[model samples]
Target: MSLRGKIGAGAIALASTPLILFLGTWEGTGQNIVYGDKLARGLPTVCKGLTEHTSPYPLVIGDFWSDARCAEVESLVIRKGQLALADCLTNQQIGQNTFDALSSHAHNVGTSNTCASRAVGLINAGHLAEGCKALAWAPNGTTPVWAYVTDAAGQKHFVPGLHSRRRAEARLCIQ
Candidate 1:
């Protein structure tokens, strides 16, 4: 082989190494869930804030989280949520907007629960709009749900902020 050919081959191999490593890490870590930048940042902050301040939610009374710690937590939460959403879907190849939106929903709703959730069912059934709608209002049958629950008197207490969340999820799903 020519010297130029050898150099070109070496360069290609070197360039491919990072790509290969990144793909491996992404797959192994389940970080392949494509999150739009904005949603990635917004979901965690929204969730954390709601957790800290929302009523009927266990009141967390301290500004204990440093910026870095908060960011770390958010990153972890989003990644886990994305993985959960991806796992729930029989079709993993989805758009970035859908991925971000579902990840946000799952982060709030719990991944395993979301996997078996009405939202996922709707999505898998090809009812995208209805699926997004379900994400907003439907009850997740999976164990370990959030603070929203029913009382002995048969009154239900749903999360107040979830309406907005549903809208957001719907928007992303449609996009």
Candidate 2:
């Protein structure tokens, strides 16, 4: 093979290596750890105070489910699901922080709802900054509500915890 051809092949191999490693064992682990820490230890938005507040999702927060193991498992599952949804919805490549932030938002809001969200649409359209900002909006009737929730009467309520969560996510997205 020509020297130039060999160099090109070597470059291709090197490029693919990180991706291979990332997609292999490295996948889902980072986001899981991040979200786990954020949720379990209490983010500025969710799970604050020592008083055992209710979780955003009723299904995840069952009776007597306020243990460390439960928090870890819930965070892991949420991050994994959100990351998968972000992968499916995004058209452009995003950084780890951005992806993780989106995962967090998606975790709070249902992945299916996120898929239909204006945030996802903006991301797919390459309006990433706008999309990240859009994540701050709370979905009506969704579990966890992250930053905002709508009552049965459709009144939108601002949740400090959810707002804090959204700020963190937006900050991560830009970084």
Q: Model 1: per-residue lDDT, tens digit, 1-175?
A: 3222333454212112332233233222323222222222322222243332121323333324444544454455454445445556654334455555665555555667777877778877777766766666544433222335455566666544445555656666667
- Give each model a TM-score: 0.54, 0.52
- Tens digits of per-residue lDDT for model 2 on 1-175? 3222333454212112332232223123222122222333333222211112223443222224334644454455543464456445645455555555665555556567777777778877888887777776533423333465666567777767667666766666667
User: What ranges in model 1 sit over 4 Å off?
Assistant: 1-63, 137-154
Q: Worst 10-residue stretch by lDDT in candidate 1?
A: 11-20
* Residue pair clashes in candidate 2: 45-161, 146-162, 147-162
Best by TM-score: 1
The per-model lDDT (C-alpha) reads: 0.47, 0.49
Q: lDDT for model 2, on a 0 to 1 scale?
A: 0.49
Winning model by lDDT: 2
